[model samples]
Target: MADKIFRNGEIVDGSGKARFKADLAVEGDTIVAIGDLKDMQAPEIIDISGKVICPGFIDMHSHTDMSIAYIPEADSLLHQGITTAVTGHCGESPVPVTNHNRSYFRNPDEIKDIDLPWERLETMGGFLGFLEEIGTSLNITPIVGQGAIRSAVVGFSAERPTEDQMEAMQQLVEQAMDEGAIGISTGLIYPPGSYASTEELIEVTKPVGRRGGIYFSHIRDEGDKLIEATKEEIEIGRKTGAAIHHSHFKAAGRDNWEKAEPALRLIDQAVAEGLQMTSDMYPYTAGATGLVALLPEWAQEGGLGDIVKRLSDKATRLKMVASMKTEGFFSIAEWDKVLIAGSSNPAYSGKYISELAETSGKTPYDWIFDALLETRGQIGMILFMMSEENVKMQFNRPYMMVGTDASGMLFEGPFAQGAHPRAMGTFPRFLGKYVRDEKVLPLEEAIHRISGLPAWKLNFKDRGLIRRGYKADLVVFDPATILDKADFINPFQKPVGIDYVLVNGQTVVKFNVHTHARPGVITTH
Candidate 1:
């Protein structure tokens, strides 16, 4: 006897293969069988005719480390058929916090409104325990953030770590792995991860390789220095012997779009040489991050407080302005592409830099600086920098996966205003627009990107596949009708056609509505 059975569905087993007609039976938190179950005895039998049953989607690169602590229901994630989220991407995790570096780490301004109940956790284990105690609607795994570890020991300094500091950082990585962190992540574009050299990264990730954990990175440069950065990332993986996973991989700005192919070639070359490497990307060309990221790396050193002080100094401000004009992948003329995605100032929340500059009788530079000052370095910006052709090209790669690169946000609340639509629309958009509408990728391949592929990256044998005896984390949806409703202007809306979602054999979403079920646990490698 089974707990429940889903019958009369087309099953896509999440292996990038063909679909088959089958019935799946659930017993407790595992799938008991997958075959013809016409006579299977169970307390409940759900008719899933005209729907496709597949393993629940896994967000390979997520930033819900702190957001999950606030909104544990994970309404947006549940609605998108995401049963598991691989959090702590781009070198932002909530644990291993010291009084010295916790406040300045990650995107604090985005979730400033939510009163996080467990912000004081000091270790990776404590952070995971807090989530379990609060109850989450989906499984969440964390990768120990390299930025947090660096900031805690180095305090936003641009200089190389001392021999003692380097050893301490390695110990932190080993400790985090022991405490259940599945891997290590680095936002190389963000400080102090940016401050770290290749040697430092290789040394610190030694434990990850030893423990068979992955090395996830938001590589040093994604535009002009993309190939150079990719080589460095691969070199680190080679030296450390850790599997490499790139986050939100893209070549930013219009001019650098052509570098996408060469970057892919470099990745392929690494793989051909027996280096294990993969990457995850959202479907859209536009990418979002903190507004302060536009500042030259030197200006951002010494943490937010120091940067704030430097922004107010005329000489320092002039140097920053000069750097902004000639230093980045984007020029001053492209300020319009850098729209304000979120801000503490309600008036400037959704406005672009060009519009805000004209309205405020200031130049784009002045507007950007003033906005950053007003928001206390908390403003978020969306950069429409990548080419659509490049986005589709990445999908053709066998190792490519899908990730929102956005944190979990609520439809209405402290975290809703100006949130990127990717939070709600990423998986559905990949399935609906990319796979079904545009025909860029077949449905089977798309399912594998979000499911089995990511699970394989994390070494989770029991999930990410609709196999007998695997964990019963699954989704059932109407392939013809599924589509993302969230858009750039109004991003708080959820998608349609994701009718049923089960996490750990518990139905958390039915008829596109969350049941407020928190069946998630911290799955560690």
Candidate 2:
């Protein structure tokens, strides 16, 4: 709780207004004052020397759930100047609920290692206890996942929930919110969540909506069915009366190239109609996900073992491939578009399906299946299927904000050095490539997208802005040189020129590197 004075820095308060010079005073975890040469004495004084001091960035659509438990300091992200993250994205988290939903898929480590405690999570506070027992690098606020809720109520089966089942699911959401959850998230393309119809979501979201919690989604499809899916999301929000967020927003496929404008228009219309809506997008042309994302929804019905069984059986593989072909999942000719991002078997990293297939003299499908076998269906793939123009168009939209869609891992960890470049590359890429060179948006405006907008969407009061009384989660950076060096082939490379990051008024990262200080806490509404 000692006092410190930050002297002579340009403060971009993240209000999307104008930047101004100020001398800020930090005492304990909050910014006590901001003025010119305040008549105050502090024990420590740091001269910023005219750098831009902005609020800490928030990742709205992040998936940094388990990684933070291992490397709690989060050197990679904090060095790039992020202080807050929203995990439990795209469904599923170890939230304390109950035995019915808790008996879903196991983590690869837990499945391969111990007979760990498994049951319904009764409270968010209990889950927070688990996190506190471990630790984290940045403030983490979680969204109650619809997939986890569905699993607790109905398992991964695609059948509609009975009345009692639906009621139980609604009660679970109420309990989670009573403890801490800010909102609810759904990954419709993934599992039990993808199988949920509008009616089911409305019933589940009723408790969430009544609690003033937000409802976020990854929607049913990201490629062909996107426009309708977005509209469907809006409809759900309208029905439930919950603020909506579209996770990892993007436009993909040749046919969907023109969908961005209409899609954005639809969002704007929804906003005009008094529905609150916002979205987060990664700054990349490709999208990353589990390799099984290409499988027909029907093929992935029963879960990991089912998918593995289908992959192992030649007849089932043929049936799956035919379904994929009919659905235009990968278009046989474009098989090279998929590259391995990570695998339990590290030998497959960076190799494309086409390259691996050529080596074995088999089709890309066979190569993917073989790799799936080796990794036990835990392989991650980066699909180079999005149009760059479509991507830029979405980024230029004002409502679009920044999200890493990645974890807070080091160059080496359970997450290997080069997995998804977005992990270390997103914020810097926004600053260096787009803001500075491409003239995509004004620098301050871009900063707002990464910093303030996300905080606003999640209703994080008194954070994500440089103002008196707000938490002093701030970053000082050199605008001219900030950039991300990571690429698809080298995903974990550190970004350059982010000088200092303060999380919750703690200098967790200083002089452009991690202090390896675990100062983060589990944040709640």
Candidate 3:
């Protein structure tokens, strides 16, 4: 007898094949049987007639690890039918902690009220062990962040690494790979990681390539230099032999909207040349990041303390503003398009830069500097820079996959600040709007991108499919009613029609409500 059986559902097995009616059985944490399981007896049987049964969605890119310690239940993600997440993305992870880089481990402003044991979770192995000990709501495949690794060895200096330092960095990558990291991720636009030269990136990624791990990167620039950045990423992959993945792939800013297709062609050319290349994007047009990203890279050097000190000086502040204006930073002509996604000050939360500036009788630059100082450089901003047409076009591409690029949050909690709607509604939005309504791609292909495609990319052998003997991570939803309700004004709203979700054969969501189950595990390549 099986532990449970799901009967009468239309199965889309995450293989991009047509759906078919079937009954699936699960015993313990694995799917024991499939096809006609009506003859089998089980302790519990679920009749999911008329519902679509598919493999649980795998978020190709996420930063959930940053807050998973506090919100272990992962309410927002479970509600959207995500059973696994590729975390530690965009060159940010909570590991490789040392005396020289302890302060840079966690963003103090992002996490509050919870006491985390930083010492015990210092290295990649230690962090994975801690997650196993405490349990999580979704399986996490952690990518060792290059930024954290660089900071651990060389602090935040922009100076080139010494030969000894380079060797030490390579050793860290090897250690992380040995400790179950799937790959090394880089936020090339951010500090520390951004400071690295192309040669340094190729050298560091050599170990990951040798170990069959992917090199995921948020490229240096997504605006005027989008094509060049894509080429740079391809060169790193060509030199290191590592599979390359572009994180949150986008051509940002109004002036660069037409660059999307050309940048993607660069990826296709690389793929044709036999280099493994892929990219992921969220459904929304706007992108979110720290407000500090507004400053010139020079001003963003060192730590938060250094940045705050510089912002306090009137002369330096004016110089930074002038540089931003001259460079047309982020290709912005209007400050109204920039909204505060998160802030330590409630007054600034959910408001646009232009609105706040106008109300205070200050210029946008002055208001921005004041806000950063008031919050100690802990503000988050959302820039509406991408074209909607480009977003739809990208999703239609065969190599493009979906990712939230946002952290998990609950409706009512400290974690529920002003967040991008993607955090709570990425998968459903992609399915409901793009696939079901707009007909961007066939339903089967859309499901595959969120499931099998990402799983195959990460080399997950057992999950991301509905085969007998595979791990029984699944989701059952109504195709017609599935839709994402979360928006910029109310990001905490959950999606509808996600009837049931299972993680490792245990029900984590039933009737669209979380069961608070912690059956998730730490997955590795």
Candidate 4:
């Protein structure tokens, strides 16, 4: 490896330590040394006199599985200094293997949008190889999705895996771990994953503990049933003895915000009783998801096809309307707080359901039923269901990490058309609003939540810290001007003041702009 020296920069090092001045030397992808510039001799050197060099930010949770193929440069994320991301969250991802019913890895129909060219690898090694061939912007490791695997083993039917099917799922997890999946993930609220029983989850995730990987999920609910849902998760953790991490764990709805203590207490008890646990949360008051997720299980029984069929069936739709009138997904009051996130049909993007009802001359409930019937259940919404004070209270905890529950995307492209704003605005929003502006958390603690904490938790041995022998995935920024510019209406704007971002010794972002460099690698567990 040829030596390259980065001379004279202040290093934050991701250790929650105070910044210190240094000259860093890189040999190929890893930082070989860090010291005074006077001691450095390198074949090539770049002077970084007035910048802060830190360990690359690790996106603890991201949804870049399919989107990475669309935008390999990760132009937006790299500019914000994200060097590593854990994709395939929410139990959605494309895998490599193919079985008789459906292929492995590439199982769930969510990935059907992408024409998966490489499906026979059937292992993590091949998936990594395919990503390398496809090109990418940052280091990434995939979590073998239980939902995709379940869809592969037992089709997308909303039912439990039979005993035989259960064994097949067990085999799938073992195979995935052998391949390179670092952990297992599921979004219990999203079917066909929602249909999985706790025992079934325990059986499948037990292998993760056996293989030394973690188990994480978006549990069945984060609302009124959050306490029960949390206990259910802890029960699974207790049974499997797997290290567990909860995803986007904010208290939602009117009365649930007060339940954060008991929820965290459950995790704390699990820890005391000897189950290693951690969790991540986005620092926002609103939560985003599809309208389908808001429907009752019976309403979304089969799949998108069945959903469309039911929505279009006047009789079935009327029955659903009656059921939803009293028993909505989250709660009754939450109805007032729901807002449309991104709609492919710009005629409705960013409009609140209640507001739209007034304009369209219908009750909010009637409008929702009509909209679903009209759009065929394809629309998504962002709900200001989370309590703002609760978001701050949760983020203030030590165990919580940060994640953008969406994909990395460019400002334009039809692919970016109707996605949540989390993808574009998460990391910067944390630094700008929470840490700098609101003074919710100090910068060191915020960086720890975003970078080092996750690195240690994920066991990415060589990439989390900014020190000699570490990977040169680094973020340099002018903290004062660092802020996310993406808003609810136009949520694709790139952030400002992120001066330089390097991934594995290559400069992907310089002067706060993408440099047309693809330095990211397919990271393995």
Question: How close is every model to the real structure, measured as TM-score?
Answer: 0.97, 0.95, 0.98, 0.92
Best by TM-score: 3
Evaluated against the true structure, the overall lDDT of model 2 is 0.79
Tens digit of per-residue lDDT, candidate 2, span 185-216 = 99898887888998898888888788788888
Residue 28 lDDT (model 4): 79
Scored against the true structure, residue 67 in model 3 reaches a CA lDDT of 77
Determine which window of 10 residues in candidate 3 has minimal summed lDDT: 325-334
Q: Write the per-residue lDDT of candidate 1 for residues 1-525, one digit (tens) a residue.
A: 899999989999999899999899999999999999887889989889989999999999888887788788888888999999999888878767775576665446645455665455778888787888889999998899999888878877888889998898889888888988988999998888888888889989999988888999899888888889999999989998899998888988877899999999999998899988999999998888888988988899888788889888879988998888776534523867877887888788777888999999998877877878878887888888889999988899999999989777778876678777898899999999989998988899889989999898888979999998999999999999898999877889989988899999999999977898899988874
From the highest lDDT down, the ranking of the candidates is 3, 1, 2, 4
lDDT of 2 at 82: 85
Q: How well does model 1 score by local distance difference test?
A: 0.87
Q: Which candidate model has the greater TM-score, 1 or 3?
A: 3
* Backbone-clash count (model 2): 9
Candidate with more favorable, higher lDDT: 2 or 3: 3
Residue pairs in candidate 1 whose N, alpha carbon or C atoms collide under 3 angstroms = none
lDDT tens digits, residues 1-525, model 4? 437777788777788888788888888788888878676678887787776677888887888776787577776677667899898787776663456334333435345566655553455567667778877879887888887778778766877778998998888888877867888888887777778989889999989888778888788878777889998888887788678999888777777788887898888788788787889988778778886666777787666667778766778867876777555464534556777776546687778787899999987766776787676566888888777788777877787888888777777776666656667777888888888998988888788888888988888878788867778898877677788887766777888878778899887888867887777876764
Superior candidate under TM-score, 1 versus 2:
1
Q: TM-score winner between 2 and 3, please give it.
A: 3
> What alpha-carbon RMSD in Å does predicted model 1 have with respect to the real structure?
1.7
Candidate 3: Cα lDDT at 520: 96
